[model samples]
Target: MSYRSWCLALGLCLINGPLLAIERAWPITEGMDVVGELSHAEAAYEDTLIDVARRHQVGFEAIRRANPEVNTWIPGEGTRILLPHKFILPDARRQDIVVNLPEMRLYYFPRDESRVMSYPVSIGRMDWGTPVGTLDVIEKRENPSWTPPDSVRKAYAERGEELPRVVPPGPDNPMGDYAIRLSRPSYLIHGTNWSTGIGMRSTHGCIRMDNDDIGELYSRVSLGTSVNIVNQPIKVGWRKGLLYLEAHPPLEELEDDAKGMDEAVAKVMDAVGERDARVDWSRVRSALNEVSGVPQVVGWEADQPLTTSTSATSSARAEPPAADP
Candidate 1:
């Protein structure tokens, strides 16, 4: 049967939501069809991307995939992201949507749900920040229009080039070929004129998925599907008897915050009183430097340093974007 026909046969259409727990590395089974989870939310923060992911217990890749449109290095102030803390696998015949804010990525759980596929994304920028709230897919379009927002028009007007109200869909169109309008006006899940900006922060206030990925998602989801937007900054886990932390601070935390990143790392270490712990200072420092917010750990640690693990029981899974020093 054809793809659409198959969907019709099952009466199962994919949907999006505001925030829902995401499944981790779930085992792919033949009979199980997993959709996005139904329970998860992002935290409010003004820190950088790395610090935000660390605090939220999610992977950097997951974050990147959820917010594909964000700039990786310079996310502006008050930018929010989705944190997948739990997994909601489908049961043999369902589909779901997953967005990880820190990594700025999105994953689509297909109807058959044999396996999950992820795509790079872009999210809100400094002034034209995206909102964090519950949303639904209200409409989907092919060859969508690129109506320039008034703010964008004003920007152009200042430059002596007054632009038209809309740009037609094509190579020059910012919306690319497909657009999924959200319940939130002026916001959408659409294609991009800027592709490298995928997996980074670069949009005014929309969830920018990859050209192909958005197309795949657009085809699967119907109007009125849920869409959840959020912001989280930290993700932690235990690996090999070590406590690992991954962080992505919000942009606001970097612009005006007075506390130095080095000092912040030292402070967190001091708080644990594990001064002698074998913490990777370089990793901590880089996260603070590159991500523009707080720092988080990506490996295990104790109040006291211990010998390296000798058994697999102590093994821990590293976050996808774990910075290697």
Candidate 2:
């Protein structure tokens, strides 16, 4: 949809009123979570930032934030881009919530001693990228109500379709079955009538998850917990003395400029603060450049080799031995 249309339709969801306030997202941590090797430089044809990130398992936001110079339309061929592949796991401390922008995923870690559970989520579009800052879940409601903001209602009225001031819970309700209020005024992590949008950039600014996923998360998380939103993909891991790396593409919206293998590797390493981990820069560069999805160990001592595993679920788990660096 056009930017104007989006603004009109979802303006209420972005209202800035003095109501329940959710905490802002946290800052990016300079840690690593060992993904796998980076490829060397590669070329792109008919590539969008989102597709490139998906191909490389990176978040669109991380790739976009990393390379601000590359335009979305003309990310020239052999551009030698870096990918945020292996990244440090987000700091989901007590009541600390984390959102990995690159992976398009949200994780809820309870404050006390509750085991954390994560779910895939679709965030805002580039025009309305989800805001990042320290935030918290402020309120919760079952069978909640949705009150379309004034701006949204005005826009619709201009279109000759005046909508209701408030919507009750039902299948047609945009807020879905359950809603968790945020500290950021009107924003929320709630269910959606558009379940397909989960894991895709379709929301205005709120985080969207599958109905089941949200339900599961709702049961586990409570109000007053911390929420952290980040965009690190390529994470570095150190097992014993071996430095390991994993490279994935950014999220859908941030992959528009994903080219230049050397630069991409450097960006990923920089995200994790492990530029010195590259034993063979050339090999690492090549892997970042490669377009294939297969995992590869670009550089390491011949005897002190590294093991790599690539799977969405494997990476999602609390710990996976196969991914040890």
Candidate 3:
């Protein structure tokens, strides 16, 4: 079956019931800047944002950002929620691993494979910010041991809880099952025992993924794979000749920085390079103000003024462009 047909089928199955812990991959067509369709799932009586996010292969922050009004802890039954499955590929080299700090997502482009896989990630907290730069995966390990750093141990001691120097691989280990060490000192992309932190700014300094996601990633990626970390809160890209913009809340530390928005807009413009298009500044401003992670059509070069079918009552509705034959 074609990629588009497969996506439609998958969407149908996903909404009907629970999903397996499998990563979703999208075909990489030539010159396409976006992939996947925006989708929604109804909240059952026992559903929370975290539950829905895990089921849909999205991060908590992404889901919350898309549906700001929904209660994170207990969104009552029948509440319409946005899945945020739609994305504009981050403005970076589409090779190996690309982790966008603001979006709380990691993308992997396998060598010679015509597809990309994405997963939600938990990055470092504001004080112990994750660095931004290109690095290589220096090592890979399974059932990794965790040794709490001096600072972490000191903090735990202040709370009257002593930590062991080396934590063995088990249920108690924070570094769950697998790890991919980056060239940057003391930082790793690894699994987490506490999966609730998978889509938020709660980690100390390393990247955290769900146990299943890290296992799949560890199996696919080899040592020396390039890992590029970037902080882009506003992303713009083209799909079927229409320009789409996706905005995420800026990191707390960078919110007050004078050069933040200017630099972000510059990056968006750079990604839309050389494509003749006129941007709808009004829509752009609205998207910026709301900071919704869902992709919105911000401009077009053709004659018809762009309009979206999405409504306030149903924000997750998507108008994916028809697939290439």
Candidate 4:
């Protein structure tokens, strides 16, 4: 579909709101548990992955993850792209910030607003993995200076770049214009001067957000907001009695081991919990095998026709075969 038509169908207008402030707040009403819908856009001649991702209010890695076959630097015009806008809330109390490392997405649930805002983030590389646990935002800073850790400075020196003990706030500072220091030592949720790395594994253990995204988040979140970092690669949840499975590629460190795969699958099933739903092992296997990072309807109420369109049943349902997985 043309960009205009896609936006209209999704009830989004390109011109009215702040491009970075994409509000995807779904009210938490009884019996409803999912937010957002699957959508798509056609690439124009001048489009890059970051351009499309920003326009759609999605993250860079998310768009890339959903369209692994497309060229990141230049997807030719007319390439139909999958927007992985649909999501299943992580298995946790929906009262604070939740960063799912495997999916490279961050969800912020504001207590007073009764809404959740999500953004794509670049996490640490395999050798410097972001920690997984509960923490609090203990400090907030604007125009924060960077103090290169010993490890980072040493790595840079080895590459023949002279190291500075501190990087002042400016164009050269990787911390961009804002930062939120977590209770975890040396870890932060901060903005980057470079946008290309916002949705990939390119950081040094601190969470990285697009400048605009981090700016907005920095302003709204308080000094003590709870932050939970998790590494769930597979998620299962229900929306109006339909069971959906969303899988992300296992972290590179865990992908080759059968035991790791089993543990991941077990976590997903555990998240599904005691909901009155049945599992279609076939669909489950397909989702597990694909690891598409898009939600798939794996089970539903027995009375509901299995072949029925999830889109028809609910506006936000994610059906099969369209997502990149």
Q: Pick the candidate with the highest lDDT.
A: 3
Which runs of model 1 end up more than 4 angstroms from their true locations?
Answer: 1-95, 110-115, 237-244, 253-325
Q: Which ten residues in a row have the lowest lDDT in candidate 2?
A: 311-320
lDDT string, candidate 1, 1-325, tens digits: 8663464356332222222322333434542322233233333333344444434433345555445566543345556565544332211122456554544655555555566755557777777777766677888899987888899899889999988988887898888878989887799999876553455567887888656667777888887776655444433333334433344555452334334453444444543353223445445455555553222343344443445432223333221224346
Instruction: At residue 37, give the lDDT of candidate 2.
Output: 35
Q: Model 3 off-target regions past 4 Å?
A: 1-23, 256-274, 303-325
Specify the poorest-scoring 10-residue window by lDDT in model 4.
Answer: 315-324
Identify the runs in model 4 with alpha carbons over 4 angstroms from their true place: 1-21, 254-276, 305-307, 310-325
TM-score to true structure, per model: 0.52, 0.56, 0.85, 0.83
Model 2 C-alpha lDDT versus the unseen true structure: 0.55
Error of 1 at 98 (Å): 3.8
Tell me model 3's lDDT, rounded to 2 decimals: 0.79
User: Per-residue lDDT for 295 in model 3?
Assistant: 87
**What TM-score does structure 3 among the candidates reach?**
0.85
CA-lDDT, candidates in order: 0.53, 0.55, 0.79, 0.77
lDDT of 2 by residue, 148-235 (tens): 8786678679999978999988988887888887899667888888653455677767887666667877887777877777765444
Which model, 1 or 4, shows the larger TM-score? 4
Query: lDDT at 242 for candidate 1?
Result: 43
Worst 10-residue lDDT window, candidate 1:
13-22
